[model samples]
Target: MIACLWARAASRKQRAGRESNREQLTAAGNGSAGPMSKKTLARPARGARGGTRRRHLTVLFTCVGRRVELIQAFRGSAERLDIDLTVVGADKSELAPALHLCDRRAVTPTVLDPGYVSALVEVVRSEGADLLIPLIDHELPVLSQARQRFEESGCLALISDPGVVSTCRDKIATYRHLKKHGIDTPRTWLLEAFAKRKSRSFPCFMKPRRGSASFGNYVIHDDEELHTLGRRVPEPIVQELVAGFEHTLDVYTGLDGIPRCVVPRRRLEVRWGEVSKGQVAKDPRLMEIGRRVAQSLPGCRGVITIQCIMSARGRIRVIEINPRFGGGAPLSILAGADLPGWIMRERLGEKPRIRMDGYTDGIRMLRFDQSVFLDRRGELL
Candidate 1:
């Protein structure tokens, strides 16, 4: 009887919270109704008096590369909620495929450039973007550091803390952080330390400390190969290679810094370091690891991709953590994670109910390319 009563109370509280959120959204939209002027781009606009208002939210996606599927997912979510979502895609190249699919498109300077953040801010101001989602790995740290600037302009930047970004960007720091948190990660050695010790095991792995896309990653079977690659790859780090099945976990946390969902995808086939074929796994061990990693990084928000290897003996070792959305996140989304919807709801001041067991297991994704057309004049057709 006590448990039933508690369940009833919780359900009532959830309903009340949702009602409050809806009221707040409606009130804000109504109060801000006005002519669609340049100044009005920064926020949602509502209709005056008893007239209907088209409530809209503008979101900016930076470094959008082959992420058309993700943008479409957001669009689909907005349509379901009756929200006018303006998706603005920004990239360094105008020809990026995803750019053509956005409601508005802009070419921004590279993240390495000093003016990258400023340029992005200007785009946000001009487009009236309410949210900014950085898609690329290298750009994550830069945007994370400038998150406050974006927020100050009425745009929320979905990024982890700068410290977490740094740790994820550098493999050496990533291993240290995981081990520090009592998480199992592969044993790693700095290039200099490995050279000095000369006692490292064979069949080790070497990769750039700050690389992405599986670039500069190699399996070193001997000291000679390690030395050769160490000279070729900059800032190389070696790790004890664990032969096992790899898995990628899509961990989503709310702005309150609490993990709300974890979807572990088993990698079946990888092409160019990106998952070309994968399946969602409901393994409890993987879920627990994802939860622990999420809790470890309290400042993490949105989707964090964790890479781990499970040995034949069932020992799990976390290999990498990317604080941004992974290349294979579309698979998890298709498996019913609804991360895009969750993010939109949370940003609208709605507390999304955590559905840890919402996703389907053994659901597979086989990726293929789709074409976009352009005219000779370089305009999208």
Candidate 2:
């Protein structure tokens, strides 16, 4: 039964692809091949119309924190596909900014809670969500472990393998994995090991072994601060403080776990560990490094964000890897990567044409704050 369903989906994708080709040809013949608008570019090619009459596709985003831009991207993708998309947002708090923007909303248990997985599964079942996208680091491992259970309930969970998630979550594990793949990574030492050695120079960086959003991260310029932070930070790991330009690469791999596209964006300014100002960098060296990193992680699927630094000496050193969409992914999408649209097509069993250099270079993104108002009755204004 599963094979049959997949076969049917593949057939539909082929028909749609052919139709899209024909439309493009028609447009070219009419001498109108300049550039397509966003709406036209997002529209799926016309295909046969007799599967399910009411084609409702629900995508549930779990741990939707401050990803309002990501939610908007998916909403735009659904509009382009002309699908009846009901975006369901789930978070542990009602005050999550993205929650108010969802079509339906639910508050889920924290990932460490014993009932977290069950609560998420219940939301998927009750809302009839067709897909699940996890947005936070801690939830990735949990969701990846429960992926098969969600699949059994006829919902697709967009997550990497549990082992891959584990590696990405732990700084020590990530450093080791990348270094083993012949990738240059910052030298790392556990807090205890560093404390014992006491031989390395100061001005090193330290952070929790398993944390995100730049929490509990510090740069110690002297032995005094190092000792102070070592006692304050939890499970701290010391790493060489890299000096150079930092870049974030947004990479997308297909369901087959093969990387299809990579977008390298240089970080100009960051706030709260999230990119506040960035520019699309079309450097070939950075692109090559991104490709190599994506190809090395065989268990990674969907979107993987890599952080690296290009030193003053002109060598690239990897810093971290997050096996999900990064906070600044919207910048890549706006630069014409169209990742959200590609994800939607892939989820429907369609293969999107790979365009590694599709996005424009030197496109800058400047982010600003927006306000959301609520009434006394707790309703959105």
Runs of candidate 2 with Cα error greater than 4 angstroms are 1-56
Report the Cα RMSD per candidate: 10.2, 12.8
Q: After superposition, how far is residue 103 of candidate 1 from its true place, in Å?
A: 0.9
| TM-score against native, each model | 0.86, 0.85
For candidate 1, what's the RMSD?
10.2
Expressed as tens digits, the lDDT of each residue in 1-381 for candidate 2 is 122332344334324434443221111122233332221113222221225443356778989977877777775655566655667788888788777666676777788998888777677666666678899898998899999877755577889898889998999999999989999999999987876784877789999999898999999888789888889898999999999999999988856677777899999999999899999998888888888988888888889999999987779999999999999998788787888777766766567897878888988888888655668975666
Query: TM-score for model 1?
Result: 0.86
How much does candidate 2 score in TM-score?
0.85
Question: Where does candidate 2 have its weakest 10-residue lDDT segment?
Answer: 22-31
* Worst window of 10 by summed lDDT in candidate 1: 22-31
Error of 1 at 40 (Å): 12
Q: What would you estimate as the lDDT of candidate 1?
A: 0.79
